[model samples]
Target: MTSEPAQHPFLKMANVNVALGDRNVLHDINLTIQTGEHVAILGANGCGKSTLIRTMTCELYPAIPGLDQPRPEVSLFGHSRWDLTELRKHFGVVSDSHPGLYSTSRAPDTAGSSTGRTTGLNAVIAGFFSASTLWPNLIVTDEMRQRATEALERIHASHLINHLVGEMSAGEKRRILIARALAHRPQQLLLDEPSNALDLAAQRDLRESLRGLIADGVGLILVTHHLNDIPPEIERVILMQKGRIVADGPREQLLTAPVLSDLLGTEVRIGEQDGWLHSW
Candidate 1:
């Protein structure tokens, strides 16, 4: 986890607009995720928070115009996304949409032969492979495996290495998903609602994990609807209302009653737990 970008403008957005069918989902949108910033995209359901996340990462919502989503030419590091394949070694994405179907088993077909025996740790391990799990030559070094073990240990998922996904609790699966994300060793973590299904204790663990991440200087952009999900290290908030960013500034400036209450469209009380911001 590195601190700031080696250069300026790691991710830039300009005049971005997206629509779902005839309904306009995103207005003329513009935003940027800085090198050292950890921003949380907050909004009510159907307020286009999820839509914005998909669009920013070049993913299309169901029943959209074409089969594939259209992504603007993004300049990551210094090269365009087209020519930046190798350069993309610096990026990682974590989403709830990932199915447990894909795996890290060197013999995916072998696992396919028998259904229901893969653990969450196994799924997390699968994230290490660049391609599908069916590749004949699957190789992971001892150190990398050790790192994976350490990552799971960080989240208390090490004990679940042998427990199949079907047997593990929801929180366990979520932790594994996060562990998989860390396997990418991302400098900037894009979390698509990391706390969505977590319980209070699990959420606390995630908060601590995020604290550790920022402590090491990794940038993060977490998409969440609740104020509590906003990690303490996050200095800024980008409130999204009706697909466009309504407010963007420091947490102290934007997380106030006037700003957040307006964005949420209801009266809510905000409280701070440790360094995190919470709404009630």
Candidate 2:
């Protein structure tokens, strides 16, 4: 009898060793994220959460396990080899620095600063070329514009299309970033510290926007240190400590008071209310 085809996980890193300047940052890491899954990577600062996200997004490569051990593999959609740009088409990434890319006001003396306002539509259109702002040399077609508009519409930000990026609120700007990333119609979205520098109201709006994306069938991988940053849709939780994965399981299994306390290295009380988690 013939055997079935091998299953391909959406994102997989097995026996991964990542180092920076001879100092090992991640050790023997093995993580697998399946299609359509919502997962949150939780940890304090310098716990390797950002490194893990960067590795998953292909911004960093895994190191050889050791001289005696065979080289490990990092796969996206089951393939280890990829043209970076072409591979980016498969998924979109949103990092904390994304908002800065929308900045319009800058001192003339600031090095590498370009001063210009970007409308919501233009912001989304720039994603087609992976540029932070629409530049003179970038070529844009009617279809690309339409796709950008549709992406904004999908995220309920079409109304802000004419608004300049500098004028929008933090929450609105974040939605525009989402629209920009979605313009490519990628299968998955990677978010790093998505709720950073947002007020309570903006955080609520951001969470709602995330729900909209999930409803549209976009898989999400969220990396954040805040408990409330995790939306209700995320089912799995991965905890990191000192550059290693300490726990990986369903949210319910990992978000308990004791576990969270240990993960954060503090004695705290955790409470759940209205599908949101808060700790003190």
Candidate 3:
């Protein structure tokens, strides 16, 4: 009897190429994450890590191969075709660039002190609508509210339900965003530079919150330049340089001083303290 073909991973891309305007942002990329696997993509700025995540989520499309060439493939949940709305329901994405956290007219330094914005619970509720805030025309059902409330509780954030996002601490606000993503009950969580603006203590809190999610069986995809941002639970690492992946392997193999130094184009000393990775 013939053997059946191997099952496609939950997310997979092979020979993927992406261009933004005239610049080639990603080249010959291949990534595969089986269901329930947690991975990190590490690189310096402009290394195309963000582009790769965007492409994976369908925000950016991979370039089609030339005539007679094998087609570049990107599949989610084992399927090549997707309805954008349905596709998004499978993954929760959080990014520093996410709106609603900062007002367009507000100064950057005033991020956590700005006023008249969505509250923490409301922000999580907005996830149901796929919006930064609930649009006036959209009708919210009672079930949506319950889900949002439960999401906040999952992260121990139910107390912030009534607090304005701009008035909360940076760490608290980030947890609220995580709650927003969890409200959707997605299979995986994608975080892009999650600890970008938090202080050291806040970073610790964020890590703790992420550990809780991992304990709850949520898959994580962490993309960041900061080594500390990679929670210890994520075992696989993909190192990128320029616009290509230079290494992909278990965390222990790829996070050594020499490998990290080469990946970031600078001297990097990596240390582990209390099961967390730190680089300097």
Candidate 4:
């Protein structure tokens, strides 16, 4: 019956469990995410990454049976996260096909060449309503608009404010979506595969941008399948396999060849130099 995401230390999960179609997809999960710390969630595809994402946002299931008795109850700021409205104050979500966040937005009175254009700036504006996209009579005000625009500017997407939804490049769209998430200035950033499909330069840019946010003390939860995608800023990683946690600890302790190889069920070697982690 709490509301906030445990403002005390950070985000914590105690004996969390999740399922899909009567088959448990996640089991007995315990994790902690503190403010200003960037944590990565790494696993093979369908290893419960998305399920964990939905759980953090309180969008997973209404009544995760057995929650009261070690169920997948989500809490933030030392309170239950059932209150969708208050729950968002500390979390921002980004995923592929997040609707208007992608191209093909149906905004009227638009100009030509709307293809691949991202009006994601508007989605940043929609953060006040906790919506993935803008809607009719959505109750926005002048101050809110200013804040949203400022957030876009922070991510250097102010110029794309009026760009058609389908006109921007992949990287541009991604930045806009991040801007939208940051527009609310949530305490924690819940990112899902942030580096997927991004080229080297774009990936570098993303890395550079994250430095500032991490320095600012924002808690970050990132997910990716590649070990290289885990940023240097990430202090901890929780490896998942078959919907269960395999290893969890400091980046150095858990991201090594032995740990990673064990979790991955293969003989893998890990190397790190200058904060970049790679596996072979």
Candidate 5:
């Protein structure tokens, strides 16, 4: 009998370099994340964490190979190129900086004129079309609606289904955005600075939701500067500085005060409670 074919990693990069505008954002990067792995990319601001995520999602491309240099390798699920729409089916992305996600427009007469018209449910449904909000021209089937509702329930945000996106609080909006990403049931989720604007209670709630996803076997790739944002379920940590990864190892090995202090460019203190790491 033939052995089963080897599985490709969810994401892989080798000798990768990325540049944006006048600056090089990622340099000679080599990374791999297998299926079902929960990993965190941690770093200070402008360390290229977001740029790396973009590269993985195909929003950015690696630098062209020089005349005499071997080509850089950047692939998702073992494919070097992809149709973006099809790629979204495999990877769901949530980022605060994703444009038009919460764009505001004039609301109807019943709601405040300044509020956004997109309701939480509609926003989630837009995931099927890869659009920020449902457009009149786009077709949304009943099955898609059902999936969106289930996604909200999974994230524990069903109460916000009818709430206008602009009317909900920051935490509530985040849950909706996560649900939007989950609507299609992607194999993995990519979150960029997910807790950026959440309050303490909201942060706790978000962590609980993330833990639920982990328990359900959905993989996560979290990119954040805050140590607290690294969920307990994430076993691996990759620390980045100045556009390069400085350390890649188990969470326990890389989250020490010394490692963090060097990564963050300051003296650091750390503590752990319930498998979550916090720093000051």
Candidate 6:
């Protein structure tokens, strides 16, 4: 009899702890995520969701194990360490608060900074270097430009190609940032509060874009505090509280009013419309 191939996990963490400055932000985090899985990491502000994302991206390292303690295990694609430049090829990261998304260049004589003035297409191409903007020293080949154009098309932001990122609306800028992340054609995307500071119309548009990505088989690891940010395609939900994961389960089970009320430390009411959940 033939046997099935073993499944390889995209990410795994056991007994992981992270500290920022003097505070230990993540504690005893045990998580396993398979390739192509759609999952949401839900939490309130200050719950360490951002820290966890950083750790996954290798921007932050876990606390070293004590001599008497078992070593903490954290791996991505079964590897414990990665080169950031190469890592961007496999996993794209987008955060609403990323300064690069709003970065701008100033005149050589100017004393103050401004919003990012790079055009959308150039910004996407910069993804290859994991840079905020294309620098004079960077070499962008024809293939890179083509890939950047394709990424914009995939996100339905081709119209934004020539638009300056600083001049685009919040929604437009968000789309450009997403295109930047997609430029490398990564297998999965890690998003942090992607819908933050967006209006009603923009939020709807962002969700539609996300759905399209999911349809194209790009796995998503979405971290957000807003219930509405959880796309319908996401079936698994992991809840974090006080720097720890408190619950991890199917969305239908963990998104109930009582569960959310406890998680948010308030009396919460929820409603569903067209597979999207809203909280009150």
- Tell me, by TM-score, which candidate is best: 5
What lDDT does each candidate get?
0.64, 0.78, 0.79, 0.70, 0.82, 0.82
1-280: candidate 2 lDDT, tens digit per residue: 1221124577888889888888989988888898667889999899998778778767688875657886788888878766656655667777754333322223331223431377789878887776667899999999999999998888778898888776677788778777777887877888888888788988887888888888878889899988988888888999999999989999999988899888888986888888988878
224-276 per-residue lDDT for model 5 (tens digits): 98999888889999999999998999998998999888888899999889888
Candidate 3: where are CA atoms >4 Å away?
Answer: 1-8, 98-115
lDDT at 270 for candidate 2? 82
> What TM value does model 6 have?
0.90
TM-score of decoy 1: 0.79
Q: Least accurate stretch of 10 residues (summed lDDT) in model 5?
A: 101-110
Q: What ranges in model 4 sit over 4 Å off?
A: 1-6, 62-72, 97-120, 130-136
Compared with the true structure, what per-residue lDDT tens digits does model 3 show for residues 1-280? 1221124467888988899998889999888898667999999999998888778777788887789767898888788777656654667778765443221112342444333367777777877766666668878899889999998998888889998776778788788778878887777888888897799898887888889888998888999999888888999999999899989999999989999887777899988998888988
Compared with the true structure, the alpha-carbon lDDT of candidate 3 equals 0.79
TM-score of each: 0.79, 0.89, 0.89, 0.83, 0.91, 0.90
Q: Candidate 5, after superposition: displacement of residue 183 in Å?
A: 0.6
Where model 1 places Cα greater than 4 Å from the true spot, the runs are 1-5, 60-74, 82-88, 98-116, 130-144, 154-156
| Tens digit of per-residue lDDT, candidate 6, span 127-196 | 6776667888999999999999999999889999987766777788788778878887878788888888
lDDT of 5 at 263: 85
- The residue pairs in collision within model 2 are none
Worst 10 residues of 4 by lDDT: 100-109
- CA RMSD, predictions in order: 5.6, 4.2, 4.4, 3.9, 3.7, 4.3
Q: Is candidate 4 or candidate 5 better by lDDT?
A: 5
Off by over 4 Å in 5: 1-6, 100-115
Better of 3 and 5 by lDDT: 5
Worst 10 residues of 3 by lDDT: 100-109
**Pairs clashing within candidate 1:** none
